[model samples]
Target chain A: MSDKDTTYQVPIGPIHPALKEPFMINFRLDGETIVDAEAHPGMNHRGIEFMGMHRNPLKVIPLSERICGICSIVHQHMFTTAVEHAAGIEPTNRARYIRTIMAELERIHSHVLWAGVAAHEIGFDTHLHFTWKVREKVMDLLEYIAGNRVNYSMWTIGGVRRDITEKMYPKVNETLDYYESLYKKLEEIFLGDPSIRLRTKDIGILTEEEALRLCGVGPTVRASGVKKDVRIDQPYAAYGDLDLDYVIPSRYGYENTGDVFSKTLVRLKELVQSIDLIRQCVDQMPEGDIDSEPKKAVLLNKLKKADGEGIGRIEAPRGEAFHYARLKEGQEELDCWKIRASTYNNLTTYAPMFMGEQIADIPIIAACIDPCIGCMDRAEIVEINSGERYSYTHEELHVLSVEKTKKILEGSL
Target chain B: MNTIDLPMSLDELESYFKEGLGDSISDLRKEEIKKGLNNRPVKLIWFTVSRGSFRKSIELISDIQIPHLSVTSGSDLGDVVELIYHFAVNYGYPGDEVSVNIKVHLPKDDLTIPTITDLVPGAITTEREKQEFLGIKVENIPDSRRLWLDEGFPEDRYPWRWDETGMENMSRYVHDKEEAANPPTEDTPREGGGKDE
Candidate 1:
């Protein structure tokens, strides 16, 4: 067969084989190696922006929170911040601190969940079970604070709907302590485990230049030693008063390799940093009304009469995400609304990371970004010359990944 | 409030664009919102550049620092499509980041903006999204295929637009539009009460 005939197209999802988020990555493979990769997202686009533009500003809060199940707080924070910015309304100082704590708590939960998913992707079920079991403490805290584990509608336009009152401080501290206690063990399993090191080290490497050119966000880019965290770079809410630094891989004597290992390193370290940040917020949280304009009628009237543009940017657990909100005078609805999630920017970096990697590495590399992508489904492989097709279910993909791990353990890979 | 350890301040950026783009730049404004106990300022610079000077303004910004393009937000504003390029500069320097939002008004008749993928490779996603949603052609985009909308979604009907070519015909707003056409005078009450009616 000619060299051209050897190329095969492997489409691994707009039907995700990983999590429930639907995203498709089409791979042009030469033999078992991925020659090129492209991301096809939007299978799950509910047109949230369209819905947001149609509704009044206040009604859009719940809609924004539903944007991503994993990062609901991220969306709600951006939406409220954007609306508040446009309307020129300052959230109470206490509200800012509460927002910071909630955001940091969400970050911890998200990163811990991501750790479990990453472990599962590499066929480490025990690690997955352990990480997930450990993640419950934060989830419980979140539920206690916001009354909902997933879509915590704690945010309002001017301020927040909920407060991190003294009643909830003990639960928050206990959760933080639980994670802090488990941090070292979690670190050892994901970072120190030799098998995981084999699968992740120098695998799916994205250089700093590629990261910068592609505008990759979150730990995905920070792994490459990029200082682009929104929290540190542009302080919003209580981040301005708080002290924090970038969580790049090099900070702990590791090279900024921009590999899957570096990415893991960044996330695991951030878990500790998140714990520190939440504690700072709890200690320094001020005394004031959680809601700036508690009267809904007054807030709604102000919003309807406000005419301006605002942008809300946040450093989500995954990366830097922002929302654009425009309010017009005498308009009951938003003049314009745009929500840019972190995965949207990180999607571009997939091309560079997937290039020249083996098919077995797809799951780990794909999950490395902690993608808030589309739902999981089966993958189909097409052979060009034969015009033949084969399908791989999620179970089959998991098997392939597990088998790869076995091979690596046996030193056959 | 936007204290920076870097050489470039928010004011310097304002002057830099003025010097580089000259008359093409208009509606220049610098805003800093203070927050938190420290009262730290979140700095932002908003300005408009003629479509002819759009790429030039970005290049001038690039001369000082490698500007990070944080997606573009586009809207269908009556006779023109407004595209705002939100770029963040001085990221490595902590607490010094400035959101330089550059606006360009593309007339509805000629809805085209040159692709900045060459300058900002990551902009391809947002640019492609703008093309499919607003029906504004991104001039010379490397990959111009639709990003968000389905293949079966009508090509002529832009969802963001509220005009004849927009999706208003099939939208719920279509019914509301007819009702809105009639005036609500002193005899009739508005949709929401004037003072809790």
Candidate 2:
């Protein structure tokens, strides 16, 4: 084909390595720059919202946790808060603190995990390894406190299931101190390192206007200088009492450039914010009954009689995790259930961010949002008339991206 | 003394709607839903508008500085599907989020509503979802292609519906205890549950 006739379309997923979860991005490229892009995500669709409506109110907490593995505790917290609202159940002060502790710890681990993934996307293997090595401490603490590493079944309708006893205080404090020490190391390596700065500084710029118009949440919008955090705006659990500061890029001495670098800074600082929140929860935890009634029988009995709807919106490490539950009077099951996971709202920002960016920058720019495709992966690429199927593995896409980067550098693109 | 009894922002949001929408609103109720130990109450303001005022209701809510459209959920009420559009009012105002949901009931025969994608681009995915799962046709949606389901999947069969054709395999979960107590003979194995023994 002639150079004028060679406009190409690239299919980059359904299954990919640059992302931790499954989703597809088909881009229409004009030479070296992306002209337009379409995201197809459903490969990981488990119909959790649909399924949540079918199950008993109490049983859906664990199911909701599976919506995003990385944000499991956040999901549980959202679901429980909604159910607690509908049922008119108030968790004790201690339970609120415990829930906050668990959610913030999850945020720390999740943000650290995202940092490693972002580092890997930029071809920094040592940085990825180092970031993940620091993540293990938080993971171990999660295991020690909640008794599970990934999906900590810590939340219930009225309160938390497990209490953070006095004995666990030492380990929790130690983990917080451990994460505190790594903050400088993380910033020095990810932000101070010249290569990372070169790759991420002005790449994939998303302005505050675009962030607001697209309804970006969590770190994605925070990095773009929107001081909107669900925890700060609509405090749930112990967030109101924590007196926390919003962790945006501007606060860390960087003008919000709304780029991959800003995104990295937002997440890294959130790691620090989460650690402080957890320590505060530990220190301020009061002695009280964890739940109005700890038994599932009493909880379910109470919920079955609830006759109202409640909205639970929390700031997951990624962004705002929202859950809406309607419980009709005298019904054991939910009338309607909807989950707007943070990643779902953030997904809309991708097409805008992808515009005018180089192929090589796609991985990190797309990863900059910290997308959790596990919550949203219904993807397919098909020809309209012929019904022909097209797909690309993560390796093939990565190679294509890297090749384009090299071409641009050689002035041959 | 329940902690959930605190004053809610839903009252403020309701008054905003009452002043803005006026006669367009059919029903509005603000309820204090959840209470936190530190006096942060989670509040919900639910209102229903006629299908004619659905678009106006959404526009008014957006005008009230609540541009964040969280999610839209629907439930099958036999002949009608009640669609609830949830928005976070007073967003970015710390500890003052009032969830204002504008609900509209669309009949099964006419399952269409004007798309909010133009007003809020973030709503495209959720609108696409309702189109696929709830079988609610979003009129003027930018992309009408199936969002979650494959092209080859049955177009008439919606996953969230409670009709005879929908969720056939999942009938056990949908059916009430009385119906579930006696398993449908068609679902049960024939002749002592033997496989060509």
Candidate 3:
């Protein structure tokens, strides 16, 4: 096609080499700048929310875990809390403390995962490998406590399913100490590297005004100088009791670009804060039943007339997760259950952020908000040729197979 | 901060709503429930009018507009589908929550209701998803685009349909197969499948 008749369109994903998931984005580019972008998110719509309404509360707990693998515990925590709130039962003090510990542990693991991904995005493979090696400590601790690496069904309706045993305290402490040392190493790598600063600083900048208008939550909002945190504003899960300081990125030493650099700094600082919070929970341990005795008589009686409405909001690793449930009398199932994740609220602003960014900076810009592409169930990539298309799975790119190398060597050598 | 006595009678709560919102209300009653539960005071009020009357209901409670729409939940209860619009009003002075349930019944075929999206933008996604999921058509909604409907789940397939999914059949077959394969033998009544047996 000649230049006069040709149109420049970049199709990203459904199958992309960079992205870890399946879904596509079509970007209409004009001279290295994105003019218009369309997002398609139905690649892995498992109908989890629809499944939640029909499944019994007990079964829904595990279903929630499958929503996002990285933040599996937080999903179950939010769902169980919503159910408990609807039933008008608050977990015991001991249970609340246990819940907080589990959540912070999740935050530690998730942030480490994000850091590794961010490093890999910027062509820093060594940093990625080292960070992930450190991240295994947290994952191992999770396994020891919950008996599984990923989908730990530790959260129950009224309280946590498993109590923190006395034997696990030392292991938890050792894990925290390891993470503390890892944090210092990551800070040195992220903050001290000139190439990383050049790549990330002042790129994908989200101003305070834009952040507020877009209703961006969590670290994205915090990096933009918004001091609002759900844990501080509406304290839950023993966060109110813990005397920990909210970590906000400082504008002084680092350039307050409100870009990916600032966001990375904020997440790194929060990692340190999470480590401290875990230590506090372990030290100031409370004594009581991890779960209150089941109110069988009340539940059975209420099961007949137990129709009520309740809203449960929790600050998950990504952002605030809202669950609304209503019970109808004499109904064997819930009348209605509505859920809104933080990512659902944040996706509205992606178009505005992607508008003026250079085509080369798309990955870093998207990662600035700590974009959970998996949550969106979508991918973002650019197609260079019109008729020719290329695609690769995440396993092929991230986890290189032996066959890939054998073919390449056979051809080249 | 009005502290209503515990287990307040249905008549007493009706008078409170009438006095609170100066409008002549009717059909205020306690929803039927099983006994032996910890009974918290609740009142359901149904307006004796059409969709336009919702504005009047809103105006009556304008003074107490602190009410948050907990959720706009719809369900297909087999016979007559029900749309339970739950609103919880938080009085600053009182530390308690006063929940009011406005129940509207729509015929199974024509499950259309005037959209409340204009009143609350947050309700837009929930209402649209419900319309697409349960085949409840919410009229006047801004974005009528199918949210999760692109999955070829079929219109009104309602993944929650237990009879259609045949989970019972699957569970029964699996259970029967397990029982037959490992029938409790007299030598090993507990079915431990010991080497001796």
The most accurate candidate by TM-score is: 1
What fraction of the reference interface contacts is present in each model, in order? Answer: 0.72, 0.55, 0.08
lDDT string, candidate 3, B62-90, tens digits:
33432334455555667556665555343
Q: Kindly report which residue pairs in candidate 3 clash with one another.
A: A12-A381
Report the Cα RMSD per candidate: 5.3, 5.6, 10.4
| TM per prediction | 0.94, 0.89, 0.71
TM-score of chain A of each: 0.98, 0.91, 0.86
Candidate 1 chain A has its poorest 10 consecutive residues by lDDT at A371-380
Clashing pairs in 2: A41-A377, A41-A378, A42-A377, A42-A378, A42-A379, A43-A377, A43-A378, A218-A319, A233-B95
Q: How well is candidate 3 docked (DockQ)?
A: 0.08
Cα lDDT tens digits for candidate 3, A1-413: 22422335666555432335555556666666766665544556666766676666666778888887778876787777667656666677788888889999999988888888777766677887988888898999999998988898888766788889779999999999888877777998997777677667777777766665444567876777755465654455777666655455764365445677888898898898898888888877688877764654554455446576555556777776667666667765665666666665555445666676666655555566665563223222434454444443444333322232233345641
CAPRI quality of model 2: acceptable
Better of 1 and 2 by lDDT: 1
Off by over 4 Å in 2: A1-4, A374-392, A399-413, B1-12, B169-197
Give residue A193's error in model 2 in angstroms: 1.0
DockQ order of candidates, top first? 1, 2, 3
Candidate 3: regions farther than 4 A off = A1-7, A15-19, A244-246, A250-257, A294-305, A375-413, B1-131, B134-143, B155-197
Who wins the DockQ comparison?
1
Every model: iRMSD: 0.8, 1.7, 8.2
